[model samples]
Target: MPMLGFLERLKFAQNFCKSTSLVSLILVIQSQLTLTIVPLHFSSSHILIKLSISALLLIIISGFSKCLKRLFGVSASAPALVLFNVLFVWGMHLFVIQKAIPSAANVGFNMECVLLMIGFFSILASDPGWVTDDCYGLEGAVGGTVSDAGRPCEALEVTAELSLSGGSFATRRIRYCKSCKRDIIGFDHHCPAFGNCIGKNNHPLFMVLLVGFLAVEIAYIVSSTQFTKESAIMGSALLETTLSGNLVVSTMLFSALQVLWQIVFLMWHVYCICFNIKTEEWINWKKYPEFQLPIQSQLGESYSEMAFINPYDKGISRNIMEFLSSTG
Candidate 1:
């Protein structure tokens, strides 16, 4: 029995290492590809704006699709495609647009590295201890004994019902999640791009990345002088010229569209943060009532309004440590 226990422990350790290593490799590949494709000298603002639009669309589409998949028995691949597009665009920005040297591209790369490091450390610091089933088959709670499906049960009495009404479930147990041990707190669906759970500890980093990336993209767009270049070149021509009018109209339209899109995207993030809600949780309103109306209305309240405003405060850290220690 002792030898069997040792083997099982060793197997679990091996599996854990394999999972972590695979995730690290994928992130490294993604970062390298991003740095390779995205242009280093393009207007930071333009790049930032484009990327932000793409990310926001991906998040919304993916979040809704995931919810739909759970509600209906549908495939989750459609939403996954949206997520892929967002990551692909980001990779292009890093690799093609950003310069290899100490330029905007390098800055973006460094920021990504820092965010990824934080995510890595957060995962490591989290505890993976949890309960597990003994048998490899289904065990239904019929009568006092929990027997495998093969055994004939007297009646199907719901002794301890565990339903996946909102979340994903495989058979009788909650489906395995790579990063989190159980149902994530303030749970957002898994981010395949990040290859991690966007839960309590890492949600801050996700928000930081979203805001920082938008800022960087906006800076790039403004600095690139896309509009200025067009204006300056077009000014040399006659005012009444058809080409001049076309240039002005086109530039104006583009600028308006860009500004509107950025505002909408930024506002969405602000709303999520203020409401203390995850994108997934917000979208799946029926699933999470804690964030819904009446009980926790005034969803637009800012972080300052919350009792624990400063996440990085020493007191907050101490409390977290104490909680973890006790739980451990």
Candidate 2:
């Protein structure tokens, strides 16, 4: 029995190491970059120790993701996405900022990281307005007047009205997330990549995460511009060379992709915030042209009517503030 127990433990450890392999590689490279470039003050042995600790931390962080998911009893759709964000941010710091620029953990950069980390974890772990009978005053009754509370229940309250095809109205207050197999109150779609529903509660935090990450990337790009070019004549040539190189090339490519996509994402979110509409609603409008508000007719006459009205849109400034607070 003791031998069997040891075998089981060995099996578990093997599985864990396999799971954390990619994360550990990224961490080790990131740590090495930090010591070699960021501070440039650590000895080789100390850098080696730092790399070892980073590997340990990767395992610990993987365990932490599991703990957070189970503790909240949520089956995250995108655990890997959260982990990737960690790697991406660290890559920017270690590969791009540390390598290209000379700033070594300055106060402004550290504070930006502080905000980024706070927002990242909050989105990964925070509740996104799950439907609950207990909170809605449905007594000791399990799944009374709605679906089951802690299971693959879909029945949620109907508070708002959505116009369906053929003039039908959807009055459900919450959204049924087929992905989460759970009822969500004011439920946004299940963003498996985000590992949470972009629901009423933590939607703002997720938006903040997007904005903060974008800001961080923008700041890094601005700071690293001087390092990216040696002279004006070799502008495109230098970039191409960086792409061919292993370390800086990969980092540069990653930075370019991130900067482009993050800018678009941040801008779209800003539009949503200004309109005081949920991302789900906006997505539906894009996919279904019928859902969009009818534009003014060419002759200033009435065209088709809008499918529904947004009650939350007070004004652009107010909507922005509301989203900032996530009260909506």
Q: How high is each candidate's TM-score? A: 0.34, 0.56
The per-prediction CA RMSD against the true structure, in angstroms, equals 13.7, 13.1
Candidate that would win on TM-score? 2
Please list all clashing residue pairs in model 2, or write none if there are none: 78-192, 157-173, 158-172, 158-173, 159-173
- Tell me how far the alpha carbon of residue 13 in candidate 2 is from the true structure, in angstroms, after superposition: 17
Consecutive 10-residue window with the lowest summed lDDT within model 1: 151-160
Residue-wise lDDT of candidate 1 within 1-328, one digit each (tens)?
4465457556544544553444334443343333322122122336455444444443554465457558864433322332333344344345433432346545765566456445443443332222233322323432234334332221221112222232222211222233443434334456554445555445555555555544544543442244335444323344333432232222222333445565776677555555434466445444332222333436686433212222212354564453334222
Evaluate model 2: give its lDDT.
Answer: 0.52
Top lDDT: which candidate number?
A: 2
